[model samples]
Target: MGIVSTYLRAFNTNKLDPYPVEILKRVDKPTTVVLESEIPRLDERESGFNRAHRGDFGPHLTRERQRFVGKHPLSAALGNMQFTLAHVVDGIVAQEKAPLPNDPALMARHIKETAYFLRADIVAVSELPSYAVYSHSMATGEPVELNHKYAISIIVDQDWKTAEATVGNDWISNSMSFVAYSTSGFIACILADYIRRLGYPARAHHARNYQVVIPPILLKAGIGEMCRIGDIVLNPFLGPRFKAAVVTTDLPLAVDKPIDFGLQDFCSKCGKCARYCPTGSISFGEKVTRNGYEKWPNDMEKCTRGRVGNTKGSGCGVCVAVCSWNKPYTPFHRLVQWSMRNIPVARRFAVWGDDLLGYGQPKLKNKWWLDLEEVDGKLIVPTQAGQRGNHRRKQA
Candidate 1:
């Protein structure tokens, strides 16, 4: 067998090491989930944030969208940096192709290595699915006609220390998202530009500028499985605690298959995210087929309201903070994670143990950020803050 085939087989059989960083290298095909029907193309304008911006959710959410970034000073700063790089996602390509070996496997390996070198938490490549491309851009009301052959998916972890500290909907919420967004965008931009220098058509898709849907690309790239948090893909290691950026290109490269890692079974039984969601947006029922995929669907309007119209905090990440898979990578935790993946019988205990150990509760001792919000162009600590912890208690 070829090296890639051998590695994939080893991964499928669980022969490789189970380290967090090495998880991507071991994945082959999805163990449980399967795409039974063709997914329909979607417009970017139909997304939750865009719907909120257009006042579909309500006037409150539309107004909140305007101040969503600037409401938190740290988020404003980080968002500024991210927005600045959006302009460079696509640029001129070299006229002459570089003299390089025509090996897809080698190219894929090099690209993944470069992404890791750029500080990406995880990286994977997959064939770009046509349905994954948005029919129209949200920023500009023009058609998105990206025909890139491959997608290089880059994931960046939002600092676990910060995630562990707050109540997951406090002042630091948007900052955590922006940090990952900006870092992943930066890496994707550079990677796309590098590919263009080799005379290939390439484009970077990130938070500030995206022509493609992330969850499908993430799934096709073997990044993670669609968890119970609606459309969010959850890595066995990072859960839903990270953000993604994609580099689409005509550059030849090997593609990764979707992975399972027992996420569907685990997410079905563990409803901690649904239990802790401040607005109760996540569904606690069985997975339903939505737009061709079988998954739990969240209330988009409610989710948007909790995020954009949030008064007690900047933006919500309560689900990310409370997921059973979102654990620190200590040795013991890693062993438990492995069991959660391979041992189906252990999943129930794992779910129960997560709540028993208070894993999803806010770690006030780890709190590092100051609770500040920008209002009317002035920084102030609002008196309405700190109620999310109380809300969590009430829910418990």
Candidate 2:
């Protein structure tokens, strides 16, 4: 068997580890009990990506789109799959306005089931908040407004084997990322197309190809809670290891409430991501209020510059690699997760134990793919691909 196959089998049949992991509490409505925020409506242009391109962050970050993951050959090919299928002038407007038995509940079930069938890790529905829509398009500099009332969030996990095998910001970094990006993008497009066939307006929002911001919509959908990694939402199950794509539509369906898994407190104490960040882009300081949102005040410019100009790799995910929450979905890890969630004292021990067990460091034997860098229409070996890797640490 391949390295990934072997790892999957091991992860699946963790019979030796007798710890139990349970499902998180699901609610009838969205609630933000822990995240205290005067979270104001943010313009689409205000995002770090747009800011970087528009020179708000700096001149260097302007190269983000042209260079970072998307611009690389492997990532570009994956993106092409998304771009080729992103828009459908005819398919989006179903040939016959066929209506299913106007049962929003059934529609919701069928939609979620369809996404699951398409390989989505998890699915949830929520009311897409107005503030979540971007004010303008980053690519065309044009106004983009989707009046879709509901958002169906589809999440896809970046395979654990890859994340475990390679240092987060190596040559294979973007490949690991694009696999999830393109897969989720394909699923979103299909779901949107399905919704359109139902005679309702639906649009697929994928990586950088979106008419709306995803974080708030995700929060509203009860998919995840915001973590210390600068407004990035982390799922109880997937943690920060997965990427999300949204299917925005006017489908009348049951909506989910925001979830509070006591992450705000956990993040306050465990800043492993911040400590492991190579560029010091992630903040170790306490969360601060910014633009009506109560979160960390990270240097978007620094983050963008680090990503765009990484001499060692196409992009970085070291933060995700080092995150204590990004573990396998096994009984043992699940118990650890529950402990971290329910027991405050366990949080500190979990962070320390994660390092002692060498969770963040790469398992070089599991490395399967070649470390080839796609540059200027040529694939070349990166000079210092995994040299700086991850640092060994005892505590946060």
* lDDT top scorer: 1
Q: Which candidate number would show the highest TM-score if scored against the true structure? A: 1
* lDDT of each candidate versus the true structure: 0.84, 0.74
The superposed Cα distance between candidate 2 and the true structure at residue 252, in angstroms, equals 0.7
In candidate 1, where is summed lDDT lowest over 10 consecutive residues? Answer: 387-396
lDDT of 1 by residue, 102-192 (tens): 9998888888888888999889899998999999999889998999899999999998888887788888899999999999999999999
How close is each model in CA RMSD to the real structure? 4.5, 5.8
| Candidate 2 lDDT over residue span 191-308, tens digit each | 8887787788888898747877888888778778888888688988778988888988887987766776678888887788887777777887777767556676677767777776
Clash pairs for candidate 1: none
Cα deviation of 144, candidate 2, in Å: 2.3
lDDT score, candidate 1: 0.84
User: Which ten contiguous residues of candidate 2 have the minimum total lDDT?
Assistant: 14-23
* Reference-based TM-score, model 1: 0.91
